[model samples]
Target chain A: MTSSTTEPIKITSKEQAEWFLNQYDTFLFDCDGVLWLGTHLLPRTKEILNYLTELGKKLIFVTNNSTKSRLTYTKKFASFGINVTEDQIFTSGYASAVYVRDFLKLQPGKDKIWIFGEAGIGEELATMGFESLGGIDTRLDEPFDATTSPFLQNGLDDDVKCVIAGLDTKVNYHRLAITLQYLRKTESVHFVGTNVDSTFPQKGMILPGAGSMVESIATSSGRRPSYCGKPNANMLNTIISAKNLERSKCCMVGDRLNTDMKFGVEGKLGGTLLVLSGIETEERALEINEAYPRPKYYIDTLGDIFDLTH
Target chain B: MTSSTTEPIKITSKEQAEWFLNQYDTFLFDCDGVLWLGTHLLPRTKEILNYLTELGKKLIFVTNNSTKSRLTYTKKFASFGINVTEDQIFTSGYASAVYVRDFLKLQPGKDKIWIFGEAGIGEELATMGFESLGGIDTRLDEPFDATTSPFLQNGLDDDVKCVIAGLDTKVNYHRLAITLQYLRKTESVHFVGTNVDSTFPQKGMILPGAGSMVESIATSSGRRPSYCGKPNANMLNTIISAKNLERSKCCMVGDRLNTDMKFGVEGKLGGTLLVLSGIETEERALEINEAYPRPKYYIDTLGDIFDLTH
Candidate 1:
């Protein structure tokens, strides 16, 4: 059996760490649960930020939760006692919007959206300057009363360019019916989902997250949503491009093994820290580590950053 | 517009009627919304039944909704003024149970199950003599407690002989989480969904149905349930066996184009009747007919059965 040592273990042996540190210039972190869960920042999170800042390490907060815009995350981080700008925050929502706009060659103002999500997701679409027909305030116009709203009805027309899924509590029987209807009409219409998480902690209770909602729509519509989140190639590509960092130079830290650790594995990030303060448990960590793309380090909490650097 | 008299109606003419009558000896009908939606039978449903019985046509009722057993359906149909034996009712639940028993090659009582959905679904497994868990009354055991009961939490488990989806309102957060967890662990586990319906008419209001539940589980589990309903091969197989008839000698008559018409196309049934009484609207029928699987006849209702026979 391996020795049960109290000493904080390095992600790599000293020689390996020195070798990796020598090659890597930038680091990416997953917010929510890693930096903080909701409003509660992880202990010593600020110290890690200061240490990274002093080391001149470029840091980017990559989040799959696209229910909030970068501006909102940036502002929220400030409230959590961390100073960050919008440029440092990368969201799958924004990445997806950009991807759809560029790859599909969609004109910014020309494509119409039938979005089913929160304001943050809507804002990201707007930032790309795309016209959307289904938002929180988008009216239930003529031929689509409350009962006929795509949110309420059976089918949406072929003219709909995209169908986006984010966080929407107001999602009712109608939206689902319409989504399936529209999805059946045009398979070419893009189906985008913010994340695949089934539930998220909200106000002390876990609420049905965007994933369940996205799955519902996908199942009903018989269309798979192009997931734009961690572990997805698109989000990883965005991080690589935006940070100007090589894959081998980056490290991802997070509480969820399936999301954060999977991202690190798929992206070929140099290192990953599996913190136990959020979703995955110690048992889950061990199970995950047995697989490929295992995390480089296992920390009881985010405070282990002090032991690693100091 | 062309004159109606000039068009000569172009309906199911006398020659077409004779062709249909001579072609089929066995008929398989779906119960819900096809023969009767809820407790109310469709118009001329009794007349069609009487006519088929008078002609000595072999008939079997197949339903994907597994909330009730064959016996329950037999009783329900009897109350609706149609006589049916338990042997005449075939359910997806029974098909799934048989599939599990055969695939595992397990002796009758050896296999264990962690079932989700209704009593009918569970009863099918029980009938196969499988030791089952995760029913409504099944105790919340350790490690598989309320927080982890795949059925009440998500849908079903991998250890289960089969994870069946029929109809259940208890589909909530806990069920989803556990179902996903079990699915991730075992790929060999079979997924069975009763139907692919989006919504079912309930208490005069359309309600989220089993299809939506199955879809949610499928999305998270990353496995598609082998559907055992209308248009699927299993129902056709069951119909063939139950009626002791060749596939070429069977005709499916129903109200919806997708379900009824697809059955004819795929099952190679002699004829199909697109009845306007239940699900498919006239406009939808026109669009569906243009698709690969087209209906053989369009009827105002089951009352048109007499017109064909005469």
Candidate 2:
């Protein structure tokens, strides 16, 4: 309903936790902040997920990190001793791959995808049977030479039908130069961004996220990319339709307000929950503002649900 | 003057050229597109500059290229057989250095300027007697290791007072990660951008400009950088004050309507001239719109002045 005026209900008691559990049949969780922090899983997070699964609630882990594919995320979950399958993980890389195929309806063999990102996007697209180029190419790491660079001399691959920009750690002038050429080429290929998260928490520090790469590409190409991540509604709808889940019966939980909370509220999910283990704090999130909607429920951490119930 | 409603005058006749020469005592010329196209000089450009110099009118080369310092630009001018001094060249690199030292009032030895750019910005800052770091550092080119990176372990330099972002061909994750660290440090650092030109013409192709780097840093740091290039009154005012010239007596001649023409119009310069030798075409420039001001005058090429007068 009206989220701006409504004060967020803090999940502190057992009755409140019981009400939350009974209200939603499905739960969407943000990975970086909600599920874990860096390499360490937040306390009681695994037990909470297990309890929710035992209660017959559907669980989906949504992450904006485009550097890792679904398989990589599944591996990360396995490492953390959390049983999450690849199908249950919705990374921006997987979402972009799905968008390129299903929404854009690109023919796999006929249409080629150009990547201005890391190996994650390429891996995801490859799994969907799409032939992609430019990701994790060591040649792009070399210093750009106008006279000698292969892209500059030999020209661009003409069959590239789409360009996907994501978090690229090895981003250099050579990579951006070739991407710009494809973006400005005749017959204007589709431009897509895996996500637009400005920064993500890395250990104890904040670092540039995939949004930085997307903005860089957008600036050079003078073209805005179609985003396929959280807060865009595209990714949420895709997940909903693929799993045949009702939006009214689903609850979204995340640590960030702009991406995760907005993703839930705008998508008209049943409820939105905020966890204080990631980028946002309880003080900042509770500050009533028009910029971002306050979450319906707030908890000290994602593990608070387990703590309250058990 | 209501430039949106007014049509740009095409200087085709000798009488019109004489009128233009009489109207302005000082001319601000954009280097890349106005004077030379890449390393090659346009036809009669040398002759035009010679004639203009002989006429006793002051000429200032205002360029948004931050990759090269004023000394480098002067050398470029010399290589082209054009007699020009370092003071005559006002590059974005030089302008940014001045902004940090003069406007920001950063004292030498006490305040350090961190550069997220090429050698040009460091060169300019060094010329001003300010100690700088991080520009063109080969160590940043190495693959980022969260565990082994020195910046991740030791933290950032506390003396870094300001961060200057310009066109950096060697930009990598390590560089951005370090810059983001300084920006998010307890003592906030001033963020400055050399220019905001989205793309620059490179030989035959267009590539990512300094603005792309600027936007990337801004997105990650969640801080907007103070731009010191075209369309921003800071650079124009700096030049005007340094030269002790009246704004009404100077005309800005450039190829791009957004930056060059907007700079002139917004700065309240005497007039603005558009040249067709660079990125823009006649058809696009002539299209009357409010987004960009119609130039007071336009020519087929910068050399048209020499042709008209001769």
Candidate 3:
């Protein structure tokens, strides 16, 4: 655990590829880094996904991205010339809706959730016919007298039973203020964050992610959310129960160890693979093992593995 | 200390008030509760200040509110018929400017400070001819696409040597984004907060304060500001150097324990007074001592001691 893959067998030839390809029936892949960087899809990514599909492997795209819905993800994959179904895509946003609906049993009319994210979260929550408040165009951005002793004219609703925070660009102070107010009213309001990625990738730039935005409310409220994304094992429950896949026959493929690899190891999946197409590097991955458990396999990029499939 | 002050001297009798009033010549007062509760000036507040003035005691009003400048504060006192001069007032905003200009040595001509509060913080910094970018009227509140991967089209100014965050009502995501971009640059850029109050007093409701706003920036940048208000010794240095008084001859009087009482103890002032006119009560004060050092003196209210003088 304190070092990177200790002499990991690199899949160089078709014989070596057949070893792992035959062993696992289910493959969970982290998008963004392993498949594409920003909008530019990586070379051989579509081909590898097709190759995996040809073998009748159950493929699921596990993304930490809470800004886009599963339908948007499906359209995005289609634009990339790879037809991805909604069932095969498991975004953190969709999982968050699942957490609120089925897991917590928040019925359509009885309960409401206060969202602190963008359209992705709103779209997913809408799918379950759940009502939400405090996203964009909610007009929480109206300027008030920047006074210390503010007058109370606003009324509170008793129906809000959950406060969910995700990657929000329009996250203003009022969203945080209202979220804290809901949590302070009662202990029953469950707090859930989509994911806690410290920083997220954009086009040639990295910005502060959901974890950075969520810390204020967490600190102010003196309560931490039950995170429903990667680094938490609950995200895989949907796939595990749906496929009835054995732990020994599942493998996780991701570019980072903390979220992707950690998810697999913590969830008790069969194996883990680390690719160096995104944030982590070959040298940095060795140092990272000191903190998180080492991944089972390491490769330079997804492009490096397609040669073994031949 | 791990315990509260056991058997704190309660200033009930005239003899008790005469003791500390005769011993300490330097008196520091916290504004919110000791003098007035919200907009209502407490009974006998003006009489006590006038009485202290007749006794030749040097007095200064220290406030953690950053929404107003020292000039505005002097005007506020005048409106209350107190006739207090500008020199008798020191706000957290004024202290923040002093921190950057005098303490951190951020030169006006060469270096600039980025502000994330209101006009109050900007006015104080401007008094010293220090230019700061960002704050109210910055137009960061304007709507943009709440996208996950926002492209970086804006360039950063390298002249900003210090970033000061206060209780901003207009705080948006861009302010947090720009501040992090500045801090992420060089280690030379300093981060400063007016005060770290988690929540502050409003009319009927308590809202998220400066501490809540500053946290995301502090957490994201991984750099803490040189805080310039209560519980910090720097506020005392302003009074100590100006009045040429020893710490042992000074006393701090306020309604709150954490900010006011801790300010006195941490600054090594001669005495500390806690008034139950505001947040704390007899029962709560006793329990608070378990975590923080108890104040040396306790009274029902400052109005109680004014009766002793009468």
> How does each model score on lDDT?
0.67, 0.88, 0.80
Q: Of models 1 and 3, which has the larger DockQ?
A: 3
Arrange candidates, best DockQ first: 2, 3, 1
Per-candidate TM-scores read 0.66, 0.95, 0.91
Tell me how far the alpha carbon of residue A189 in candidate 3 is from the true structure, in angstroms, after superposition.
2.3
Model 2, residue A107: C-alpha shift (Å): 0.8
Fnat of all models, as shown? 0.22, 0.87, 0.50
For residues B227-249, write the lDDT of model 2, one tens digit per residue: 99988887997899889999999
Between candidates 1 and 3, the TM-score winner:
3
- Superposed Cα deviation of residue A281, candidate 1 (Å): 15
Query: Model 3: residues >4 Å from true position, as ranges?
Result: A1-18, A144-154, B2-4, B143-154, B288-290
Across residues B10-58, which tens digit of lDDT does each residue of candidate 3 receive?
8888999988699898889999888887778989889888898899999
Off by over 4 Å in 2: A1-5, A186-188, B1-5, B151-153, B186-188
lDDT winner: 2
lDDT (tens digit, per residue) of candidate 1 on B269-300: 76665667677676665543333354566656
Candidate 3, residue A233: CA error in Å? 2.0
